[model samples]
Each structure stands twice: as structure tokens, then as C-alpha cells.
Target: MREQQENAAVLRVRGLNVDYQTKKGAAKALKDIDFAIHAGERVGLVGESGCGKSTLLKTIMGVLPKNGDVTSGRIELDGVNLLEVDDETRRKARWAEVAMITQSALNALNPVRRVGDQIIEAVRAHRPIDKQEANALVHRLFEMVGVAPERARDYPHQFSGGMRQRAVIAMALALSPKMIVADEPTTALDVIVQDQIFARLRELQAENQFALILVTHDLALVAENCQRVMVMYAGTLVESGPTEEVIAAPKHPYTIGLINAVSVLGSDKQPISIPGSPPDLMEKIDGCRFAQRCPLATSICKDQMPEAVVIASPGGERMVRCHHWQQAEDFALRASNPDVWQSVSAV
Candidate 1:
């Protein structure tokens, strides 16, 4: 039954390429990105900073900055190509079909207006509901997110950080969107609040059955909340598969490095950092972007870009982009040694 639903994806992105125009040149922010999310499925996107995670989300929401352009790709939501739609059509689709929960709730809410009014306006903008109906919906949403309904009339300054975030969640749920893109939604909250918010979000998702795309750097959070994970490196999707399988046996060197860099509880192994920063996107490169930093990279990896190779897994098909994917077991063994990573110098 799950496989059948996976076959009919709720959202799909194919061959996406995005670039930002700068004085130096066009910086390739997203390169040939492809993925799909089924109805009610949860997928986590993990990557280091400046690896195009936010860029991908902004592109999907049609909210990219003025300089950022989607050079080529198709962002299909329920078989409708979002890139082909007009500005008004895209605006209508937002919150109604897809919504975003940004990292900064303070930036998302209006400082001067009441929180409840902001949410009501969001609902009435896309929906033809009256003020009374919208107000009722806001009250219900506040209750769902653990925010007090009576406090809806309070300004953003009056609410605590956690309360503000909950209010943002309430706004995102106003229209019960089909898909929600949460980009580090709990970045500013305490650990306890983060856990609570996630618990509430899980409950809401189970009830609403909306597809969720969680963009975060927290691999532990991903392992706990998401069923699948996608790893990005230097504007490219290097690996993606079932969360458990990918976490246990990563096929990409970059993915391996990321797992090793995190400190695990009850584990004595010291975290090994991946040496070297990511490649500069402004410059054109012929080979894999991770070659300079990857200990397993060879001459071929440095000379030619590898396409994504699909491998069968117990959970499903896993995709990895590496010329030496056949030697992943060997690479994993060698990657555990800190000397191997330290020996590589960025070219």
C-alpha cells in the first residue's frame, strides 16, 4: 500500500538548476536536483551551510530573490508545473497547496498586528471565508499548536520565542496545505520546546496527512522524525535513501563524513571533521564538487562528473553520485581514519 502511494508522488522536482547572478559570475546554487515526496511521507534534507538546501526550498515556493533564477527544471505539484504558472496562480497555490515554516518566526510575523489577525488574513487571502469563520479557524489552529486561543490578539512582542513559533505553525496550518516546507523551524527554540513542537507537528501530520519536507542540519532529528534522507554537497544531491540505511551505511563519502562529524551518545569515538571547505560555485568545474575534500576521490573523480547511480536497497532504491560507489565499503573503512582526511589538500 505504501509502495503504491510512493509511485504517485504528491510533489516532484526534476533536473532543477538554479543560479544567482553576482558581480563575479553566475554562482550555481542548485545543480540538476531531483526528488519526489509522496502523500503523507516525511523526507529530511541534510547538508552543511551554503549547500543549496534553502535555495531549493525558496525555488519550490517561488520566492527566490531577484538575482536567483531557475535556469531549468520542473517543480511539479500534483501534476501541475509550478514554474509554468503565473505570479497570481503561484500566490494562490501557496498556503492553500503548499506552505513554509521558516527558521525565524520573528521575521515571519508582523510586529504591529495581532497574531490571530495575521493568520486570519492568510486564510481569507487564499480562501473566500468570512472573518468569523477565519477567526474560528485561527482559534482551532492555536489550540492545535498548544498556543492559548485567548492570546491570539496579543502582538508579536508580547509572545515568547516558543509562542511565536507556535503561532507561525498555526498560520501554516490555517489552510491545511497539502505540503509543508519547514526550514530549521526549531533553530531558535530550546531543546525541550523543539521536541514538543516536533511532537505536535507529528500529531498534526498524522491527522492532516500532509507531505512534509524538513530542511535541517540535525541528522539525529532526521533519524528520529524522517523516514528518508537526502544529502546535499556543493549544490548537488550526492546521496538519498531510507533514513536508517543511509545512516548506517552511507554510499557517498560526503555523507560518511557528515555522519562521522556528529558526536553520538554512549559512543566513545571522537568526531572526525571533514577537511576543507566546499568548492566555490562561481567557478566552473568539470568533476565532482567534493573531489577536493573527499578522501576517496581519485583522478577520475577529479576529472569527470558522475551521474546519480541507483542501487537496490531493502527499504527501496538508493541513489548515489560517486564514481567509486562500488568501493563504498572500502571507503567507509578508510574514512574512519582521521589521517586519511587530513592528508587531502583542497585543490
Candidate 2:
């Protein structure tokens, strides 16, 4: 039996379909995506570039570009439908209810303004508080994120890369938001700094009891920081479940391929790359998007899309979008053989 949590979900996304209008008709960026994040729950979204991971985050935050539209979906926060709300209401809810830490601290911060003022501005935008109160809050936030409270007056250029990122995180936490979406929060930083940033994030999440949706290309990072994992491919979610179970025994071919591709320390087995490039979103695919690359794919897989199959596990319920998920044990064994993945293109 699947374990059901008693706590209500903090964020719920159902049947989300996002499209972008292009010169060649419309491109589907997200298709029927659904998930939920409960209070203090950490979920990771992992995929290659152009897999719609970032687009999904932007859509959830209501910051999609002009060309992008949520053709169908429901985004709810604490039972409030965000997409159904008025513009003013959604605008007001942006920082106070849901905030994001973008990929780059250099680009996200304003060059001219002091970091302190920017954070204070964010706090005052939602809260009816004076500069002094906001400033005090900013100091507390800085302390929370491990940045020196005295350095709040410094400009963005004055802080190191990691410290700058902490400042951005401080801004996101100003309103005590129930959920935070971090897109590659530790990108471009050194490995040591990356560990530090995630440590701080884990500490903050524990202290505040806020939900988190972390988007990144690093499967190792997802395994380390998130309790749940969702794997995306060509704008579709292929596998989702508890992090430990999914990482240890992947059901989908794509998920297995991803695990095989990761370089394990001191392991004798060499990393094997998944064959073939991701499908083109502009083209209409009638079958499984990964059919061309999957070693276990058959004629049926090439002719039809697979629906998600739910499997109950001790950790939680596992979801795999592959027709052959029932033979996952066999697939896992075959996927371990580097020879099975030794396509000429992979070399």
C-alpha cells in the first residue's frame, strides 16, 4: 500500500500543459504534468537542458514569457488557484507566497543598488512596514542565510559568488514564503561552495518548515538534497518516486540510462551515455519520445505513448511512464551492462 501523508500539500499542480507559439505552429513545452509538494518537503526536478524543467518552474511562478502559455492546468497553493486569481492578487502573492532563487547571483541582483535596499524593498512590497522594520528583517535574514548582517549595506559586487547567492536567498526568504523554487541555485560555483550552499538551504528549510522545488541537471545533487525525485525528458515526466528507491532501482529506461551515465567514484564500471539526442519539440511525436534511444524499446513503444504505472513501495508510491516497467528488474540488470549501451554515437 502507498503511504498517505496526513499533512495537506502546500503546492499542487494538475494536468499542466504549457505551449509556446512558434513560426512552425505551436511547440509543447510541458504535457499533463502533475505533482504536489507538502510543507517542508524537498522535491527535485532533474533533466537535460531544454527538457522544460526551467519552463515548468517559471510557469508555476506565473513568470512565463510572452510566447509561453499554460493552455491547460491548475496551480493551487493552499487550495487557492493561482491561475484563476486576478492579476493584482497573483502579483501580490509572488514574493509573499512563492519566491525563487534564480541561477545566477550576478545577473539576478541589481548592479547599482545595495543588497540591503533590494531585500528591504522586497519585504516592504508585501508587508506594510517601514524601512527600519524591513531593514531589521533583512539583517535577520542575512544572519539566517549565513551572511554577515553587517555586510547588508554592501553592493552585489562586493560579495563573493557564494555570499552573493546567500544574499539572493535572503531576499527570497524575506516574506516567510511557504514554498521556494530554486533553479540551479548552486550553478557556476565551486564544488565546496556548492556543498555549503545546499547545507545552508537544508538548515533553513528545516528551521522554517517550508516546501522546496529544486531544479538542476545534477542527479547526485538531487539524491543528496531532495527526498523525492522527478525525472523529465522531452517535456514529459518519465519517473517519479522516493529518491532512494528511484536512484537505486529505476523503472523507466530513461531513468536507468541517467543513472548509468553518472560517474560513480571508485566504481570499476565506466559511465555509459544514453543513445540519441532528445526529440524535437516542434515535431509531433505519436509514440514514446524516448523510443528511438531506448534499448528495450519495441514496435509497440515506437507506435504508442506509455501511460504512467503506479507501484506501491515501502518508501512511497513509485510512478513510471514505460510499458515495460513490470519487467523493471530485468531492465535494471540489462541497463547495468555497459555493452548494451555501447552505441557508436555514445562513443
Candidate 3:
């Protein structure tokens, strides 16, 4: 059963292009994004801020803002294209098939309602269950997430930050969805709380075997929690592979910068920052979006976009979107030197 679950894909995204209409023009939030997450797998999506991590999650959840549009894409969940589904069908699927745990727990919960009642409402929305059944389910979920079942009636404000996040996790798991999208679920908490929350989440994931998509800027968190990692930049997927391989030896310049920027404990090495900011999405971009900040970029990189290349790896297939990926080993050595990144000037 575990092997079969690993072979089945829970979510598959193909040729996804999302744009947000602005006064200036349409800002490309996601460009030709494609990936898949298998059942019982955990994949981490890491990138700098404004790299369309949230945009991609929102698109998957069918909660994009009014101005944001998926111009082209097929979001296949369990062999069904969610884009073609009606609003009612999608709404029914949101928490039942695929649920999202947002970054802010306070905003996700209703301020006026009791926490248990909110979770009860979520459970009853999709399943035909009476109040007693829903209440029982909520209590079980709360216990699963390490929150006391008796305190389910507390308001959101009554729970501490970590507890609120735990409640959100319980709500997400209330319907026993096949997939869970957690967008920096513990970003606001301190180290100790963060560790405790992740420990509980790992335990629950082990018991339930739901596919998890964790979105965060912290590579260390991804390294510890995820089996695979996808690196995004300027609304594009730059690199993806097994977590250990990708972190130990990155292929894309942006990914290398991200890995190098993480501060290591007890290490004398200073974190190297990427020199320039991301390109403006509103402006028309030619060639590679990262060319201006990439030290290894050449004339071709400045004139044309690089296609995604697949490389065989011991753990799994690795994908990189860089024209100079063939020379990544040499580049990786130079990238460790701060001078290489600092020499590049933003155009």
C-alpha cells in the first residue's frame, strides 16, 4: 500500500501561467510552472520573497485574488483537472481533497467564532455529519495536533501563537485530505515552538500519509522536513531534485545563492547574499530573468530563455533551468567565493 501510494501522484501542475492585472500592465506571477507531488510525499518549495510561491499555492487552492488569473495551466488533482471544474465542485474539494494551512493563523480563523465551532463547520461543510459527530472529529483532530481536546471552545485570541497554529493544523486535517499545502506555517513562532509544531506535524503526517507541500524561504527547514525541494525565482522554477542532492550541490545560480545565504550554526563562514533584487514582473523580460544577477551568464543567457534540463541522479531525476548547467560543478566552486556574486551588476 505504501509503495502504491508513493507511485500515485496526488497533484500535478503543467504549463501553469498566472498573471495579475495591474494599472501598469499584467504582472506575470507564475510562468510555465510544472511539477508533481506524489501521495505520501513531502516536497518543499523554497525561494526568495516575491518569487510566486504564494501565488502558486493560491492558484492551486482556487483562492487567487480577483485580479489574478491563471491564463493557462492544468491543475490535476487525483486525475481530475480542477481548472475545468465548476465553482461548487472546487469548493467541495478545497478542504475534502486538498486543504491549505496559511501563513497567518489569526487571519484564517474567524475572530467571533469558537475555534472548535470553526473546525466543526469545516467538517460539516463537506461531510454529511451531525453536530455531535463533527464535535467528536474536532476533538480527535485537536488531540492529534497536540492541543487539548477540552479547550476546543476557546477563541482564537485565547490561544497562544503556537497553539493557534496547532488549531489551524487540526482544521486542515479535519477532513483527512489527500494533500496539504502549508505556507510557512510556523514562520512567526520562536525556535522552540517551531520545533514542537513540526514534530507534531511529522508525527501526524506519518500516521495519515498525506502528501505535503511546504512553502518557505528557509532552506534548513526544507532540508530537515522534505524529501524533495523545488527552488523558484522570479516566478519560475529553477531547480528541483532530492533535498540532500539539491542542497549539497545546486545547479542554478539563484539556488546556489539561496543555499549559501543560509547562516550555519558554529560556522565561521559568512552567508553570501544575492547581489540584486528580482526582475520587475510588469516589465517585459527578454532572455533569462536571472541573467542580470548571474555571474556565469553569457550572451545567450541575455537573449534567450533556458529550457528545463533533466539529469539522472542517484536518488531521483534532477531538473535545472540554466543554460550553463553543464558547467555547474566549476561554477559551484566559484560561487562559494563572494567575489563571483559581487562582481555581477544589475542591469
- TM per model? 0.97, 0.95, 0.97
Top-scoring candidate (lDDT): 1
Q: lDDT tens digits, residues 85-165, model 2? A: 999999988988999999998888998999999988777777688867877888899999999899998999999999999
lDDT of each: 0.92, 0.88, 0.91
Look at candidate 2 and tell me the lDDT of residue 232.
96
| Model 1 local distance difference test score | 0.92
Decoy 3 TM-score against native? 0.97
- In model 2, what lDDT does residue 108 have? 83
Runs of candidate 2 with Cα error greater than 4 angstroms are 1-7, 342-347
Local error of candidate 3 at residue 117 (angstroms) = 0.9
Clashing pairs in 1: none
Give one digit per residue, the lDDT tens place, for model 1 in 1-347: 55675567989999999999999989999998998998898999999999999999999999999999999999999989999999999999988899999999999999999999999888878868887887788889999999989999999999999999999999998888999999999989998999999999999999999999999999999998998999999999999999999999999999999998999889898899898899899989889999999877789888898999988889987999999888888888888889989998654
Off by over 4 Å in 1: 1-7
Error of 3 at 16 (Å): 0.4
lDDT, model 1, position 189 = 91
